[model samples]
Target chain A: MTASKDKEEISTYKTQPAEILAIRDLTDDTRYFKLRCKDITMNKDFQYRPGQFVIFSLPGVGEATFSLSSTPTRRDFIEFGIRKVGSFTEALFKLKKGDTIDIRGPYGDGFEMEDLRGRDLIIVSGGLGAVPLRSVLLYIEDRREEYNKVFFLNGARSPKDMLYKRDFIAMNQRQIIDTHLAVDEDDTGEWPYNVGFVTQLIPKLGELIDSENTTAIICGPPIMYKFVIQELLKLNIPKDQILMTLERRMKCGQGHCGHCAVGGRYTCLEGPVFTYYDVQHIKELI
Target chain B: MSKEKFPEFVELIKSKGKLFGPVKQKEKYSFEEIKDFSELDFDYQRTIISPKKFITPAKYSTLRFVKFGQTEVLPDDEPQIVMGVHPCDIHAIKILDRLFLGNIKDPYYAKRRENLIIIGHSCLPDDKCVCQSTGTDMVEDGFDLFLTELDDFYLLWVGSDKGLGIAIEAENLLEENVSEEEIQEYVRWQQERSSMFTTSIPSYKYLADIIHLNYDSDVWEQFGEKCLSCGTCSLVCPTCNCFHVDDKIMMNAEEGIRERMLDSCTLPYYSMVAGNHDFRPDRTARLKLYYTHKLKEYIGRWGQPSCVGCGRCIAYCPVDINVITVSNALFEEVCETQEVCDQ
Candidate 1:
C-alpha cells in the first residue's frame, strides 16, 4: 500500500486497503465500522478534519464517499456511519469485521474551528447527518473554552434510529452543553422528546443567538433545509452566519468527476459545506 | 513544404510510431490508424466523433485489486503520432491540458499525453463552425508540427524541438526554395480563411458576464423542450472530460478491477445524491449546466472559454440545439441596443 501522504497516489482512482476493526448495526439499514490502515504508521499518520470525506470502495463492487465520523484528534482508528442505500453500500454492509476493504481520500473542504471559534454554536442535524458534526462536537469537547454556549438538536425517526446515543448522553451531562432530541412521526417505538419536524426546536433555542457571535452549523436531509433555514432566517441570522454541509453524488472526491457539481462549484472541491450566503445563489438548492 | 512530397513525411513518421490521419469513411472523415500514406484525405469536412477519445477513452481499466486489496495501475504506454488534427481541435486539446495537467495532474491523462505527438493542419470553416468568433480558428502551440495551406504547397511551422528534429531528418523530401510568390500565397490563404466564417458572435468578450446576467433566462427553457437528451453534443466534444468509475468484483470477492468510463450530464441520474436529491433534475437545468461549464465557469478559472467552437456539438446535435446560436441570441440582442446607444 502506498503512503496516504502521496498526493498523486491518494488522488487517483486506485485505492489502498484498510481493515475493518469492528462493526456495529446502528439501525436496520445503517451500520457503523471502525477501520484502521493495514500499515501501523498510516493509521498514526492518517489524519482528517471534521466534515472532510473519504471515497470508500468495495473492490470490484463500486465506490462512494462518506464523511469521516471520527475526530481528527484521535489516531487509533477512523470511523464511518454508513447506511445501505445502493449496491456499493450493500457490498460494504455485507463485509465482516475481519474483512479488508479498499479506501481512498480524505477529500473536500472541511469545517474549521477557526471559522467557528469565539461564537456560540447551534448544530442542527437529523439521522446520519450527525456523523460529520460529531467530529466538530468532539473537537469542541476537547477545547471547551473557545466557544460560548453550545446547543445540539438531533432528530431521528425513532429511538432505535439514533446514533451514538452514549455520546449524546455524555454531552448532555456536560455543564457547557445543551442537547435536544426530536422525532418526526415515529410510530415503531417510543421516542422521548419533541414529536414534530426538527425545525420546531429552533424557536426553543432561546438566548443562544448573539447576532455577531452566534453561528449555526446544520446538516440534514435535503428537505430539512427548507424549514430549518427559514427558522434561522426568522431569528434574523445573517445568511453568512448559518453554515451547513451539502450532500451530492461525489465520485472522484477531488472534483474531477463533475458528479457533485452545484451551479458553478464542485461540491467535492469547493464544498460539502457552505454558508447560506454561498448557496443562496444556487437555484437548485432549497 | 512541397504538397506532393508531404506523403513522404507521413511515411517517415510511420516508422517512428503508429500513424493516424483523417480518413474518409462515408461523407465525414475521422482520425484512424493507417499504414499507407495515400489513405489520408484532408478535403472532407468534420469527423462524427472528436479525437479526444484517443487520450481519454470511453472505457478503460484504471486499476486492479489483488489478494490483500493492494492495487496496480494499468496505463496505456504505447506511443502515437496523431496527424492531420485541425487547429480548432488543437485548441481543444490545450484546454484539456490545462484541466488535467494543471494544479493536480490526472495521471491517466498525463501518461497518454506524454506518449502522444500532435501534427495539426488548418481546416476550412464549415457553416456550423464558430471557431473564428471563438478565436480557436488558429493556435500558437500544443502541436509539434502545424501545416497551413498555401495554394499548391503548404507552409510548415515547427512548434517544438520534436518538430524541428522531424524537419531536419526529413530535409531531403522538403523543398528549400526562397520564393516571394510562394510566401505571398500563404498570406493570401490566411486572408481567405478569415472570410470563410458563416457564423459570427456579436461579442466574445464579456460572454461570461452576459451568461451571468441571464442565468434565469427563458431561452434555456425553450431549448429544453426541444432537447432529446441524447447527449451527442457532449459525446462529440473534444473538451468534455467528465468521467465516472466503478469497481467490478468477481464471485470470488477477493479481487476486482476498477474501471473508468466517460459520463454525460444529460443522463437523468448523473447528479443524484444518496437521498435522491438531484441538483439538475430538469432538462432545462442540465442543458444550462452544460452550456455554463463551457462558456462561463471554464473561462472564470482557465482564462478562456472551454469551447473551441469546432461546432462538432452543433453538427452532431439531434435537436439542432446550437450553443453558438443560443449565445448569439443573447449577445445580438444586448449588443444591438448598446451599439444604437453609442450611435
Candidate 2:
C-alpha cells in the first residue's frame, strides 16, 4: 500500500535537473537534444512508459511539454526531437552541452504495450510526429521476440526534415523491422526515397493490408492524422486497434492546467495516445 | 445534534474576527458582513456567486519573485471563516477541494482551504434551482457545521471537531436536550418546503449517461447565440476553478509577483496557443464543454457532479443560459430520440 501510494504521489510533485548530454541538428528548424539526468541514481531509475512526455524548461524562458523520443529501457539518457516553432523550443535550440535545464515528467497515459503483446505492429508517422513513435519502435525492438511482425512508415516535408537518419538505416540493415520512408517532394538530384504522402504507402505495405492482428499507431500534424486515419480505415484496421497521438499546448504536465484537455479527457492525463474508438466520437480531438 | 444558539454562535465568530454571511447589496446579494441578525438573509436562494471569492479572490497575487541570487517562492497571508454558505455552494467547494488536493496539490488553494472554516446553510431553493438533480441539495461533509433553518431556531449538525468546539464555546446561545419529536418536525418542515423547488433536470445519473448525446443537439447553437462569452456563468460558478497564471512587476523593476486569476473557457483565447491554434474555436463547442465537464466528467471522476445547482449561472448569465435547461434537453433527447452520444 505504501509503494502504491508513492506511485500515486509520483505524478504530483516532481523535480529533476535537465543536464544536456548531447545535441544534434536534424534540420534548420529542428534539433535533437539528448538529456542525461544530473544525478546518476535518478537517471538509472527514471522509467517512463512509451507515449508519455516530459515538461522541458529553460530557466527564465518558459516550459513546454515534449514527447520523449527515447525508450524506457535506455535509462541513462532521454532524448527530445524538438521543432523550433515556439518561443520555448527556439530558446532550447540555442543551448549547448553541459547547460542546465529543468525537467518534470513522464506524465500522461502512454501506449499500452502489454495489451498489444503477440499482435502485429504498424507505426505511421508524419513530419516530426516520429518523435513519440520512435519510443514505441525502440521498445518493440528491445523485446523483438514478443511481437509477431513490425512495420514502419514515416513521412517528412523533405529528406532533410526526416528524423533519426542513422537509427533508421541501422534498423533497416538489421532487417528486424520493415521500414519505408516518404518525402513530400523530390529534390533535383539529392534524394532517392519514395516521393509522395505517407498515407500513400499504407496500401503498398501488404502486411498491414492482410493481417487481422495489426495495431497501427499514428502520430502527425492535425491534418495528417485525419488523412492517415482515413487511409488506415480504408485498409480495414479495427477502430480500437488504431492508436493516434494528440498534441496540445500543455503548461502544467498535470491535468490541473486544463490547457491540454479535449472534451472530458485531459490529453495530459487520460492520453496523448488514444485508440480511435476511444476518441472517435470526441470531435474536438481532431 | 440540537437547536443552535444563534446569537452566541454569532458572538463566538465575532470574537475570532469578522464573520461574513449573505448580505443584500442593492438588488443582488453577496457574502458580506452580518452587522446584526436581522441583516442575515437565509431565505435567499443563492448568492450572486459562491463564497470562494473570500479565499481565492477574483484576482490576487500568489508569489513574489526577487532576483536575490536565484530562488523563487511565495509569501503567505492570514485566514478567515465564511459563514452561512448554501449546501450547493459547499458542494462546489468540495469540487474545488478535489482539484486542489488531488495528485498535484496546489499550494495556493491548499493554504487558504486549510485555514478557512465553512459553515453551510440548508438552501431554500427557488424556481431555477436543480440541486436535487445534481445531488448537492445537502452536504454530508466539507463543512465544519451545517445548519437547517426552522421557524424560530436553526437545527445545527456538527461535522468536525472545530464545529463541536465552536458550539461548546457558545453555550449560552444553544438550548440542549431537545426532544426527538422537535427534530422530526424540523426535518418534515424542510422536506415540505424543499419539494416546491423546481428541478430543471431529471435524475443526475441518467443525465450523465445521455448529457452529451445531443452534441449536435440544437440547444447548444441556441445557447451559443445568446451567450456573450462574458464568462459570467463560469465566474459565478462555485466549482469552476480554471485559472491562468500571470506575472506582474512593481514600479521598481527589482521585484515582481506571479499570480493566477480565474479564467473562462467561454473566451476565444482560453485555449489559444502561440501559433494561433484555438482548440474550441467555435462558441458551441466551448459552451458544450462547460456543461459536459460539470455534469458528466466531474461526476465520472469524483462520483459527484461539479455543479451544486446554486442557480448562480441562471441568475448571473446575461442571457440566462442555465446548465439545468441544457442538461434536461439532452436527457429528453437521449431517452426519447435514441440518439448516439459523443464522449
Candidate 3:
C-alpha cells in the first residue's frame, strides 16, 4: 500500500498491492478484509487521522476507497470492514485470504482527535458507518489516559448485523470503555444488550451527554446522521465539537476528481471528517 | 526580433516534420495536418473537446505490466505537436500543466506536453464564446507562437525560439518595416473585442466570502433544478481537472496498463465509496461544489478566478446550465446589483 502524507499532493496514478491476511464474514452482506502491506512497510506505520479513507483496488477489476477501520497504532496490518453494496465491494468479497489486491492511499482528512483531548468522546455509529468510527475508537483506546470518558453507541440493522461484536463485548466486560449496542430489532435474541435504534440509547447515557467537555463523533446512513446529530444538539454539544463522516463515491482519493465534494470541500481531500459547524450551512450533505 | 515570411514559416515547420493546424470540417473545425496555409481555420470558436484529449487520450495505454518472475514496467507513446489552439484552450492546457506536470509530474502528460509546441490562435469573439470574461481573450505567454489576423496580413509574435526558427524559414512570405501603429491597432482591436466577449461575474475577490455567507441561499435549489448533471460543464471547462485511474489487464492476466481518464464531479458515482458511504450523496451538494470550486475555492488560492470564462461549457451543456448565468445570479443576490441581475 502507498500512503500519501500530504492530502492534496496525492496523484491519482500510483497503485500497490496489499495482501489479504484474513477475510471474516461479519454478516451476510458485510465482511472484514485484514490486509498487510506487500511492497511498502511504511504504510504499516501509516498514521492517518480518524475518518480518513484508503483506496483499495482489485487489479483488472477497479479501485474503491474505504475508511480505515483499524487505528493508526495498528501499523503492521490495516483492516477494512466493507458492506457488499456495489460491484467493487462485491468483487472484494469474492477474494480469499491469500489473494493479493492493489491498494493506494490512506487519503483524505480524518477525524480531528486533537481538540477532543480531556473531553468525553461520544461515538455514535449506525450500520457500516462503524467502519470509519472504529478507527477513532481504537485511537482513543490507545491513549485512554488523555481522554475523560469514551462512550461508544453503535446501531446496526439487526443483532446479527453488528460488527466487531467479540471485541466490543470484551471491551464492555473490562469496562475499559462504555459500550452501547442497539439493534433495530432483537429478532434472534442473540444479543441481550440494549435494543432499539441507536438514537434511543443517546438519551439514556445522561452523564456522557451532560459532560461539558463532550464531543460527539457520528457516522452512519443519512437518516441516522439527522437523528443522531439532532440528539447531540438536544444535549447541547457545540456544533463545531460534533464530528461526522460522510460517505461518497470517491473515484480518486485526491481532490482532483470532482467526486466526493460537499459544496466546495472535497470529502476525500478537504474532509470525510467534518464538524457540524463546517457543514451546517451546506445543505443535502447529511 | 524581426518578422519572417509566412511561406518560409510553413516550409520551415514542414521541414522539421508534420505540422498540425485547425482545418475546417463541414461547418465546424478540428485539429488536423495542414497541407497549405489556406486550410487553417482561424474562425473556429472551440474544439469539440480541449486539447487534453491529445496528452491524456480518452483511452491510452499508461504502462504495460509484464510478469517475468516479477513485474516489469513498460510505457507506450511517442511525441507530437499540437497547433492552432485557441487562447482559452491554451489556458486550459496551462491548468493541466499545473496538475499533470507540476508536483507529481505525470510522465505521460509531461512527455506529450514537452513534445508539443503550442501555437495559440487569437480569439475573434463569437456570440457563444466568453473567453474574455475568463481572462483568456488574448494569451500573453503560453505558446511557442501567437498569431493575429490583420487586414490581408497575419501578424505573428514569436514567443519561443522554435517559433523564431519557423519565422526565419518562412522568410519569403514576410514583409519588412511593418509600422508600429499597425501592431498597436491590432492589440487595441483584440482588447476591445475581448471586452465585448465577456459575461461579467461579481468581483473575483468576494466570491469565496459571498458563497460562505450565502451557503443557505435558495439559489442552489434554483441551479440544481436546472442542472442535468451530464458533466458537460466540467468536461468542457478549462479548469475542471479531476480524473480517475484504473488498471486494465489483457485476457491472459499476465500484462496490463493503468489508465487515467477525466472524471467530473457532477457524476453521482464520483464520490461513492465501497461501504455505500456517499459523501456528497445528493445532487444539490454536487452542483454547489462545482460553482464554489470555480468561483470560490480556486479564487481563494489563485487570487484570479478559476474559470477563464471560455464559453465552451456554456456552449456544450445540453441543458444550458452556464456558469456565467449561475454566477451572475449569485452576484445579483449578494451585491443586489441590477447590472448582473439583468444578465
Candidate 4:
C-alpha cells in the first residue's frame, strides 16, 4: 500500500506560489495578469500545454481554475486573462504587481498541437473564450510555417466585453491569417467589424479552402456552440476535425474530483479541450 | 475462541495504531477512533459516514504560503489501522486506491492512504444493502485479515504475512484450525447472507447500456423534481469523490493554509464555469450527471463501476430518492422501449 516518493515525479496536488509580474485590464471585470515564479516553478515539470488551466489560489479568499491565456512559447512567465465572477476571482482581480498567489497545475491534457500541424486551422471564439484560445493563437503564430492557412473568427457582445481587440486588428492586417471580428448587442455606434452572430461569419469561408482539409476549433459559451457547430457541420467539416473546449467547476484539477467530469471523463484530466468526436458519446457537454 | 474474545482482538489491534471502525452512535453507526473495545459494534444497519472519511478525511491542509515569499507544501503523514471495515467499504477503498494512486497521483490523498492497514469484516446484509447484487459483498483481496462471524465463534482468515503476525501475537485467543463441517457451515452462511439482498439492478453490465440509451429518460427528471439539490446522497456515498480546495488565512494574516474539503455534484453551481457559463444549470441535468457517472461513465473509464452496492446513498438520502429504484425504472423502461422498437 506504500509507494516510494523517490521513484515518482513531483507530487501532483502540491501548490507553489507565483508572484504577479504585471496586470493589464481588458475590461471592467477582466484583467490580464503576468506572473513569475516566486519559489519553485511547477511549470518546469508541469510542461504546461497551451489549452491547459491552473488552479489559482488567493490566500484567505478561495481557489478558482483559470486558463493559461499566455502562449507556452513564452517560457519566462505564466499569464491569465481572468474575469471577476465569484468571490475568489473578485479577490484575484484586486491583486497588483509583486503580490503573490498560490497556484497548482497547469492541469488537464491540453490541445494536441502536433495534430493540427500542416492542417488548415479555423479558430472560433466568443466573449472571453478568447482567453485560452489566445495561447493557441499565439503558439500557432510562432510556428506559422508548420500550418497551411489560419482563420480566426472572434465574437463579443459589445466593445466593453471585447478581449484582445488590438491584437486581433494587428493579426488581421498582417495578411498571413484571415481574421473576422463581430459584436452583437453593441451599444457603441460606428463599430468597424460585422455586427451579428459569429455563426454568420462562417459562411464567408466560401469554396476557396477545402472543408475536408480544415480543422475547426471552437471556444465559446454553451449557447454559442449550437449555431457555430451547425455552421461548421454544414461546411462538411469532419466531427473529429472540429474541436471544442469545455468549462466546468474543476476543484481538484485531478481526475478524482467529480466536479469537472463530463459523464465519466474528467475534463481536468482527459481535457478542457475535447474533439467533437470524443464529446459525441459524452452527455451534457457545454 | 468465540464472540466473547472480540473485545480482546480489538484491544490487540488498537495497540498497533489508531483503531477506527463502526460503532453505534445514538441510533446510527459511524467509523470513529475507538477508545473502548466494547463500543465496537460488529452489527449495524449502516454507517452514516463511510470509511472514506478515515482514509481521505473531510478536510486537511496540503500547503502553507506567506506574503511575497516561500510557499511550503506539507506532506507529513501518519500510519493507522482501520479494523472491522465491511466488504463493501473495502471495495470502495479499492476504487479510491485506483483513483488516487493511478496514472496521475493525488499527493494529498496518497500521503494518508499509504501506511494504512485495513481489516475486513465479512458482515451480514441488511434491508438496504445491495452489495450481493453488485458482487461487492464478497471481496477477494482488499484486507489483511477477513473475519467472518459464525453462530458461536469467529472464522478468521489470516490473508497476509502482516495478518499472520497479528494472529500469532495473540495465538492464545484463536483456535488452531476449523473442522470441515464448520467450514461447510461457513460457506452455507455466506450463501444465506447473499440471498438476503432484496434490491438489485437488472444486471450490472447492462447498466451502462441502459443509461446510454435513456439519457433523456423522464425518470431522472422525476427524481430531479423531488431532489432538493442538497447533495445528501453524494455526501453519504462511499465512492462519490468530488472535493474543493481553498486557502485560509491564519491569525497573523500574513500566513495561510491551503485546505481541501469534499464538494458535491448535486450543487446547482457545480458545473458553473468562468463568465457565468453553466453546463448543468438545472437539477435534472445535475442528477443525471451524478447517476450516469456512477453507473456508466466511471465503468467506462476505470473498467469498474464506482458503486459498491453499499446502498449508502439510498439509505442516507433525505428525499427518499433511491439509485436502485431509479436504475430498475430506467432499465425496465428502456428494455421495454427497445423491445417495442424491435417489434
Q: Highest TM-score: which candidate?
A: 1
User: By summed lDDT, which 10 consecutive residues of candidate 3 chain B come out lowest?
Assistant: B68-77
Cα lDDT tens digits for candidate 4, A103-125 = 87677777888888998888999
- Give the Cα RMSD of candidate 4: 3.4
Expressed as tens digits, the lDDT of each residue in A1-286 for candidate 3 is 2343543345445666778999998777888889877866555556666787887766566677788899876677889888888777778888999988777677777766777888888899988888888888888888888888789999987878888777677767877779888889888987789888989888766754554678889998888888898888888888988888887766666555556666657687668888999989776576
Q: Candidate 4 has what TM-score?
A: 0.92
Which of candidates 1 and 3 is the stronger one according to TM-score?
A: 1
lDDT of 1 by residue, A1-286 (tens): 2223554545456565789999998778888899988877766767777888888876666778989888877777889888888877887888899888777777878887776778888889988888898888888888778888888888887777778766776787774567887777778556656677778999877555776677888998877887888998887777998889999887777667777777778888778888899889777765
| RMSD (Å) per prediction | 2.7, 3.8, 4.2, 3.4
Native contact recovery (fnat) for each candidate is 0.63, 0.25, 0.54, 0.78
Compose the digit string of candidate 4's lDDT tens values, residues B1-343: 5888878877898888777878887888988888997777878757888888876778877667686554546445556788778889889989988888887677767777766778888787777888877778888776778888889888888767778889998798898978998899898998898788777755566788888888888888888898899988878888877887777888888988878878888888787866676888889898888888888878778888788988787787888776787788787777678873232
Off by over 4 Å in 2: A1-7, A11-14, A58-61, A208-210, B1-5, B14-19, B32-43, B54-64, B68-79, B202-205, B247-257, B328-343
Q: Where does the lowest 10-residue lDDT sum fall in candidate 1 chain A?
A: A1-10
For model 1, name the residue pairs that clash: A60-B247, A60-B248, A60-B249
Most accurate candidate by DockQ: 4
Chain B alone, candidate 1, TM-score of: 0.93
Lowest lDDT 10-residue stretch of candidate 4 chain A:
A1-10
As for TM-score, the candidate ahead, 2 or 4, is 4
- CA deviation > 4 Å runs, candidate 3: A1-12, A40-45, A112-115, A204-212, B1-4, B14-18, B35-38, B63-77, B99-108, B152-179, B191-235, B244-258, B265-293, B324-343
Q: Which one wins by TM-score: 1 or 2?
A: 1
Candidate 2 chain A: worst 10 consecutive residues by lDDT?
A: A1-10
lDDT for position B155 in model 2:
76
Q: Write model 2 residue lDDT over B1-343, tens digit each, in one string.
A: 3334566577677665457888887877888876676687766777776888866667766545554322344324554677888888887887887877887666656777777778888767788787877777778998988887777667777889888888788666776777787779887987796687765565466766776666778878888877788888878888887776665656776667656678888877777665666778878878888888877777668887787777788777877787766776666667577744432
